[model samples]
Target: MTKNVMVLVDEQHRLDSVTAAVEACGVRVQRVMRGMRTIVGAVSDDAAIERVQQMDGVASVREEKSFAVPPNHRDIPQ
Candidate 1:
């Protein structure tokens, strides 16, 4: 099974170091949202997520999972 991890990091520090580490672990980093200073990546093991968070300048880490929403939701409507 694949694990999806989201990390909230410190923008002051360039994510290059963390990125390099994650890449070295053979995980695919899909997107890095600059605005939120967050990164989205996928790994085969949850331990990879822990390693990513342990990298310098990481504020927090969260796992992605299933969620439910109202079918007729009108919040943030376009």
Candidate 2:
């Protein structure tokens, strides 16, 4: 199953290297927070998640939890 995850990188790691590693795992990078050293994306499966976690500069990987809200309740109308 596919899952959204937040990838945290080591401070010493270069963002380009980390991004390349994530892409190599076949995961799609949604957003890159350079200052925060965090990458958010969706992995193809559990194996992909493991692969990303084991990459050279990866510090940790955590699943991203999302919640559904009615359109009317949203901060910005759709």
Candidate 3:
């Protein structure tokens, strides 16, 4: 199953290289935070996650857990 994940890389590594590595694993990058050396995206499957984890510049790969909020709770008071 595909899952959203956060990919953390070494701060000193080049962002482009890191992105390339993740993309090569068949993962889609949703957002990139260069300062934090982090990339958020989805991996096609468990094997893709493993591949991403083994990448040279990757520090860690963590799945993103989402929590649902009620629609009423999301409204702000005027």
Candidate 4:
């Protein structure tokens, strides 16, 4: 299963090198936030996610969470 994740680059490291390393680990990088040292990306499976987590320049890897709003019904609780 594919997983969406938020990756934070370590302050001591360069984003470019880390990004290349992450892709080598199987992350399909979708976006790069140089200012924040964050990268939003996806991996093919849990193993790939694990690989990304163990990389040298990665400060953190958090799976993306999804939430949905309540249906359009007056009876629903607020």
Candidate 5:
């Protein structure tokens, strides 16, 4: 199962190196947030996330949450 993740980079390492490491771990990079020291990407499964977490420059790896609003909500006039 595929999983979306957000990776926080440590200050000691360069974002490029960390990004390369993340991509090497089989993460399909979506977008890079340089200002926030975060990388948004998707991985194949738990194993992939673990691999990313173990990388030297990675500070934290967390699952991304998605929220959506129903188009036909009873509270709103349809």
Candidate 6:
């Protein structure tokens, strides 16, 4: 079964490497949240989490579940 995961990366250089690794495993990046840091939303199996964390600059990675969307933003259909 496919699972959702959140990968947190603090280093900019690691972004590409991490993305490549996940993509190689057939994982898809669903969304990317950038704040004081970067949070990546991906869909894959548990192995993807391990692969992401092993990347050169990944700060952390964890399995995440779907929660209520933050209310601060709304859809602006064009």
Query: Candidate 4: misplaced stretches above 4 Å?
Result: 67-78
Ten contiguous residues with the weakest lDDT in model 2: 69-78
What are the clashing pairs of model 5?
none
Give per-model CA RMSD: 4.1, 4.8, 3.9, 2.1, 3.1, 7.4
Q: Which runs of model 3 end up more than 4 angstroms from their true locations?
A: 67-78
Task: Provide TM-scores for the models.
Answer: 0.71, 0.78, 0.78, 0.81, 0.81, 0.59
lDDT of each: 0.75, 0.86, 0.86, 0.90, 0.91, 0.65
lDDT of 6 by residue, 1-78 (tens): 777776676666656666666567556777666553455566646776777677766777777766564556467433
How much is the lDDT of residue 43 in candidate 4? 86
For model 5, what is the alpha-carbon lDDT of residue 67? 84
Runs with alpha carbons beyond 4 Å of true place in candidate 5: 67-78
Highest lDDT against the true fold, candidate: 5
Alpha-carbon RMSD, candidate 3 = 3.9
- Model 3 TM-score relative to the real fold: 0.78
Backbone clashes per model, in order? 0, 0, 0, 0, 0, 0
Superposed by TM-score, candidate 4 places the C-alpha of residue 16 at a distance from the truth, in angstroms, of 0.5
Q: Which residue pairs does candidate 1 place in steric collision?
A: none
RMSD of 1: 4.1
Residue-level lDDT tens digits of model 4 in 13-33:
999999999888888999999
Candidate 3 vs candidate 5: the lDDT winner is: 5
Model 1 segments more than 4 A misplaced = 71-78
RMSD of 4: 2.1
